[model samples]
Target: MLNKIKKQGFLNRISSLIIVQVIFVFAALFLIIFNYSTEGSVSKQINEVGKYQTISNEISGYLEDNISSLTTDNLRYEYIEGELASYDEILKAEILTTDKDNKLTPIFSYINSVQSVTNEIPQTYIESIAEHMISEFNKSNLKSQFAPIIYNTNNIINLLPLKNNQKTEAVLVIVSNHDFIISNRSELSYAIFLLFLIATLFSLLTVYLIFNRFKWPLNKLIYGFKKTARGELYELMEPEGDVELRALTSAFNEMSKTLWENSTQLKKSNDELEESNYLLSESRSYFKTLIEQSPDSIVVTNFSGNITFYNDKAGKLFGYKKDEIIEQHIDKFFTQPVMNTINNTDNELNGVELLAKTLDEELIPVYCIASSIEDDKSNDIAFLFIIRDISESKDFQEMMIRVDRYYTRGEMAGDIAHEINNYLAVLSGNLELMPLFMKKGQNEKIVSKLELMRKTVDNIARFANGLMDPNQDEAVFEEADINQLIENVLAFLKPQNRFDGVQINTDLSTDLPLVEFDISQLQQLIINLVYNSAEAMQQIEKEKVINIYTQPGNEGDGTVRVIICDNGPGVQSDKKEILFKKRFTTKRKGHGIGLVTCQKIIEVHSGDIGYEYDEGAKFFFDIPLKQKSKEKISEEEKASTVYGN
Candidate 1:
């Protein structure tokens, strides 16, 4: 072969080279087409497999529905059998159950057969389904579940786990003939193979004829290129071929002659373009990293409300990957109210509360603002939304309100009972002394106690009426003498509920001026604080004592100072900061709002309330002694508090 080629002319050698080149090119082409056709055949087989799986999915879904809605236990069995009959590909179907006695029972064709000893295959299939399906279903965050498919030679079988109304474990067995689907696809494969063969033969023939036409001209061009590679500038092609080849030869000669002239300019432009591309790629990567690492969840959406981009926080907030969430509707994460806010306006942002739904459909409270983005636009109007989770804030707010309500109710009950008991105490004490008064016909002590009791009853009626109508003001602020209010509270609460086992002692200063404060709130505040002290002391077996004191303005703010001292364990130093905070508890079952209520009531009356531990628990309050007019207090028909303690 080598001696014959050496003796051949340039045109003959070129013809032989063309034949060999055509064969190599056709061989590669044929190989590519053969691989493509093989892929197509495998794709058809995949479709066939999918068809069988689809029927199984349909049957499983039907069984699930029937199990949920059917009345009788056997109704679902009958319906499933009917569905199985319709699918010719499905060869047979049956239901299996594990009885309470660890026995396996086969329900064949709508009839439950005798219970048999535990069959390992059915239980194994159920466990396998549970093992694989649970993880796969959880990854998708989907509810529908099925076991991994069991493939046979020409058929498929699956034992799907199902639970009935009573949560009884059961398995549904389905057998399908996959060979039928494969047989239907075989004809398509043969036809594709035949077409492929015929096309390969025709393509090779056409390519051979086309190559013969360009063989001699291509040889001349190859010789010219070899000359140029060797730095032979005087070299040129004959330019005597076809129009296109002759034109290409002439252009090649001209390009070679001025190669160095334009090469520098071309290389400079190419270098700059490549550098610009590299810089642009780097900037894009930096921007993507910055977004992915952001703390706050940021989502960018197009005018059509599809997700264009989202940060890592956004993916975590939505329980999805960046790839999974892209092109998804923005409304999927937004609740109805948030949707209304964004869709209502054309281009406006309002910092509003919204609920975001995660992949598992859990709703989270979020504060988000959506505003239009001005950029290299691909849509009519794009939006950038910055979202922050506010679930903890909302939870804290709800807890505070609940604790406040509990303390408020306790205060109202305690104050009302204290006033009502004042009357009861007078009646019980005087009843024993009434025998002497009735025999002697004297009425000093009796008259004084009866008057005090009458006043207590009147106050109770006023308090009850105020509570009935919530809009009515319960406590009136006036120039209240501290000494007088202290005496009145003592008289009214002598037989208190929380102070039953406790002895109260008081030291009063008569020189203390009148302070502007609400009577009922002041009474409630004192009762709650005193009750708190008594309850704390109840745990100890000591003689419980509470001492009350009133003094002239002593805080340098011209405010009347009052103190309630108790012989009980004082609050811990570390825990004192939370004493005035709602929901902070120290006792085993305490609401921790009594001190908070005292703080609120003192603030309302323009006073300061605090706690300290010197000998024991010491509650102190300071109220301004500025006197105010009592015109409104006088106009009310309620009687002045008359008491003897």
Candidate 2:
């Protein structure tokens, strides 16, 4: 049954058994060797200490025995008086001496002195005993030795006197060789060497047995793990070694099997994800291409109004290149007033908006939609702007508005003219009747009344004629000398009732070029400007003047400039840009269309009208010279022939 269980590979029975036996053998051998070695060393040290103590006690006993033989009260008095001088002879006769010429010969003299019965013993005996005592001292041998005593060397012994009262006592000394202690140490050292050899041999055997039992199984498991990590399920790991190690290996093998199975499924999922990403990228590219090829202007911007992308149409509309406009703020394209409104609104200007003017001063209206674009993380990354330029549409609408205004004004003027004319005709008819009905005496009052009525009718007819003249028809372009035109305009306005209190100054440049313009319209434009100047200067009490000038401009462009300036209050700073817009009047009773009509007339002639508000209001217009063509001359001749008829 045990063999069957071991073959089943559930646990590494042989490896566990070998490991346990190896550990038990190594530990038991190590402990036994260590205990024996320690005990031997301690026993050696104790034996050496005991030998030293015995040597010390034996030396003390020898000294006491010798000193007891020498000390006597009568002998001490004789030694002090230097009587019985042969101390060596007396010591030799009283005691057994080992060597007669030994280093302790002086100790015999001291003993002889203490043994004397006479009042004196010789100083030679005392000196000899003292010399022997010192020769036997332990320090005598140590003083001559440079190394500690080994088994071959003699153990040194020292004798020292114990003084009692005034008497000098003798001391004995002994010396023994340490050969016996050395022999015992050698035996103990041999035993320790043998035990160490056995332990080393046992440890090597145990390691060999354990390695032989487990090395094959561990290598197989490692190889299996590496193959599993590489996605190669080549083989299943076979359990080896103890039960715990077999269980661990089984778990690891199962985990690797599961991982290998999941890896295949994961690869399929990754393939799908990659395909989705590719399709998304392709879709983005297609949309981008479509936007780039679009004819209508398209721009994408951030919430801060910074343009992120723009199409070619956008570049043309804004008069900027794609690279130049991208990353630039949208506010950079707006005029000051519009920019202020946009900034104040926090870039959320809604409804169909118009830019009013492009970079090149061309009127461009844009209908735009602004929407926020967020990322997958739901973060507001940017804004998308889609715009359409409506300049042509706006121009058509403006034309329609102007035509409407004209028809409405014309109708009102016609009605007023008709009523005034009827009243004038009635007054004229009454004036004629008054002349017929009056007698000579009543004729004075009737004639005076008729004269007053005729004057009122004449004034009424003049007012109606002025009102009936169509200013729009007079704005047709014709070839005329600009200098003569300006002088005529000033002359016409100088005598007007409105100019009574305003001083006029004229400086017309000679040799001016001819321009194609409507003479009546130019005159009206000048009249309006002068009238505005007069009104502006109404508050001035002194030196209220209007200066009119004409000059040739640079570039030999055949250009003529008409300037009308006044020493009047200048245009308000904030209203300067809108001064020519329809219905944007600053006066209570004045229609703002006067300056707007002037601008329109100048625009139709392919000229420009501008103003400088610094140091009072200065209005100016410049017209380019118009060259006559052969076709125009032919048309003029045909008209002349018909008129001649």
Q: Rate the local accuracy (lDDT) of all candidates.
A: 0.64, 0.58
lDDT of 2 by residue, 1-645 (tens): 787556634234445545665665565566555556556645754564454344334333343444464476444434422322332222212211234454333233223434323333344553455455544443343322111122232332223332223222333222222322333455556655665556566556556545654566677778887887687863477777655557767887787777767777787888998898898889888887888777567777775668888887778778888778788887666543433454465444464565644555655557665556788997767766666765345353344335434643453454455556666777877777775667555777787777778777765644433331343452356787777666555544454556777889888887676677766556656767777888888877878898888888666767778889998888888878776653345567765566776676576556789888757889998877773454785697699889984
Off by over 4 Å in 2: 1-11, 18-475, 480-500, 504-514, 518-524, 550-556, 571-603, 608-616, 627-645
Q: State the number of backbone clashes in model 2.
A: 17
TM-score of 2: 0.40
Give the clash count for model 1: 0
Query: How do the residues 107-155 of candidate 1 rate in per-residue lDDT, one tens digit apiece?
Result: 6532212221122235466445544443344455333334425453455
Worst 10 residues of 1 by lDDT: 111-120
Against the hidden reference, what TM-scores do the models get?
0.36, 0.40
Candidate 1: Cα lDDT at 456: 64
